[model samples]
Target: MLGIGVVASILGIAAGLLIDWFPVAASEEAKPIDTLWDVLIIASVPVFVGVSVVVLFSVVKFRMRPGEEELDGPPIHGNTKLEVVWTAIPAILLVGLCTYAFIVLTDVEKAQANTMEVRVVGEQFAWTFFYPGEDGKEISATELHLPIDRPVKFTLQAKDVLHDFWIPAFRMKKDAVPGINVTYRVTPNRLGEYPIVCAELCGLGHATMRATAVVQTEADFASWLEEAAKPPAPPAGGGGGDNGKGLFTSNGCGGCHTLADAGTNATVGPNLDEVLAGKDEAFIKTSIEDPSAEIANGYSDTMPKDYGQRLGADGVDALAKYLSEVTKEG
Candidate 1:
């Protein structure tokens, strides 16, 4: 019995050590919270082995012996001493593990120094990130970029419905609420590109709504920020107004809904300037009313299908006409 126990115990410890590799493959974070997971696994293994070994021993030793099938074994009542031992041991083990988990959570939640602030607004099937540049000037973009090895604090908000901003490699996520802002922080130690996926289901195109998170060096980030701040050149032709703004909105236009003069910086919809360039009146009108008939690549068909109902004939006509004239070539 002594030899069996010794060999089994050594094998059990080796098995536990050998299998410590995480199946999740997200070992990169190495945040203090992840250490709690290791603690839980380590503390539970010995208990698990004890249970299994006892069950196997009982099966082998107490199987129906000769003439034992028709006879009752000696009746033995539960021992209070044994009960106290098992109960107290498990309680102490649980208390210790729970205390460690709480401490880790608290540590990971502590705010860090020099964290970059970004307001993440989640819309149906898309994520729009806004960073306030110098002097309270803001930059809006679709794709996310972060400076490597810096702490980033994200303020999450939802425009229409609930969405979860999750980056698997970072092992962090937060819920975007429509009326309120939820905040979380993460420090990315590694420099690489990773996919930012929405874990929550929002609407029809939920499955297809995805974006990239480019972790760049500090120098690259400074360049990107500068370029975003510079104003675009005015259109060669006159830009539309006097409800040309509404014309822009109803068309579901703007690089990202911005009122850029002619440039499409963040346009998820049709770039009025680009799409209508060299086009005549008739083609532009047809394209607006029947958009799916001409889908734009790199964007989903999330444009309201009931535009014809909401806009009426006159609205669509004016929008297309405005687009055609202003976007005309030299």
Candidate 2:
């Protein structure tokens, strides 16, 4: 039975190790994090299997017989040596795991020269990424873009409530506190796109508070940064289609909504083609200016409250009119 238990445990460990438990490891930190996770699984499997086997074997081998209702089982004294051995073993395992974890954390967060800084701001249901620009200015972007194989430091903050910045593929996460700035460093090793998830329960839109990070070659990243750093084009006459579209992108609306015309496919909010179907300009304006006044059937009241102030009356009306035209079904 002991031999069978050992074999089963080995098989279980092997199976667990073969499972792709996490997303693709796209950053340097992911190596140590994944290794630590595998080590934990290997160490835990034997203990779990041993305990389960012993309990089941004992229950079957020494359970009360059909006619032994009034009989009492023999009492056994506790073994001090066994107790000490179990306690010592667990203590040693815990200390080893903790030490390894700390080492990985330190290595990943170690500062490096020539690291670029990116400011990450978390609001109710959107993310705004700010990259350093020429002349000490900052370039704001709705999406995050980084150069592959380069160390990048992120300074995270929350505008309203607590939020967590997590990129599962990178195996790193940090909290974004309202009144505090938390920072972390990571080096993207692979060129790919990864989801940026809010691992904390921030508010009504907690589930939909999502974003993306794109890691590209150094040259492509530099080009993107240069383009993003350019000042916004002057508003067109009367704030209509083109002006409204620019406002929509500049204000970070594409981070949440699915608008085909705007090339935004985010699922955090209702699909504009469906939600704005047949709605008039006035109704669309109300929805944008005062989103909380009428919450969508499945969405939360997670829209930012300062849009009216940020975009002003003209911008809001233009956006409303633009959506009213673009989202109308034929």
Candidate 3:
């Protein structure tokens, strides 16, 4: 029985180690997290095999024969030593695993020198990343960008409901509470793009709340940051299709509205292509400024109502004009 259990444990551990279970580890913290997961598998498989082996052995060895159906089995007594051993072993294992987990958590979350701070804001259905820019202003973008090998401390905030910011490759996640800020840190060690998701269900658009994290070379990140900090050039002839599209993306409009022209297929809110097809520029402008004024059919009034203040009159006019033209043309 012991021999069978040992072989089963070995096979189980080997299989567990061999299987690819997680996405690519893209952050320095991911290595230790992955190692902890392996340790858990290693420690767990043997116990599992032991329990399964004992149960099977007892069933096979102590089975009642057909002739003994009317006879009672001999009385069984509890072994105090065995009980103590089982309890102590599991307690020890639990303590050891918890200590190791705590150590790993501390190591990953240790504050490092020269850590960059990035502000992350979560709304009903979108994520906005804010990086420190020149003159103390923040450069906001819908996508997240970080430099490889640099530690980034994200300050997470939610404008409306609760949200969770998660990067699978980084192996770190934190909730964006509505009234307070939550923070987490990660050091990007790989230069690649990874998906950023809202792990918390915020509202009707919770599933569509997604973004991308781009881990880039230091030089490339710096160049991108500098360019993003610069004010966008006014659209030629005031507000045109290109400018409107930029506004739509930057403001996270496409996160809840489907727009064929913008290539966004989100359905959290009304489909802009259909809704704005026959609507005039004035109607589109009103929709942008005050989304609650007229709720679209089959959708909640969850669209942010501060766009009038977020985007000035000229900006709103540009977006409305762009939407009006694009929907009509399509």
Task: Report the poorest 10 consecutive residues by lDDT, candidate 2.
Answer: 233-242
Residue pairs in steric clash, candidate 1? 254-267, 255-266, 255-267, 256-266, 256-267
**TM per prediction:** 0.59, 0.81, 0.81
RMSD of candidates 1 onward, in order? 9.2, 4.4, 4.8
Could you give candidate 1's per-residue lDDT for residues 60-83 as a string of tens digits? Answer: 998897877798788999999999
Better of 1 and 2 by lDDT: 2
| lDDT at position 169, candidate 3 | 95
Q: Which ten residues in a row have the lowest lDDT in candidate 1?
A: 233-242
Ranking by TM-score: 3, 2, 1
What are the lDDT figures for the candidates, one per model?
Answer: 0.66, 0.82, 0.86
Clashes of each: 5, 0, 0
Where does candidate 2 stray beyond 4 Å? 75-77, 201-208, 233-258, 263-271, 274-280, 292-318, 328-330
lDDT agreement of model 2 with the native:
0.82
TM-score of 3: 0.81
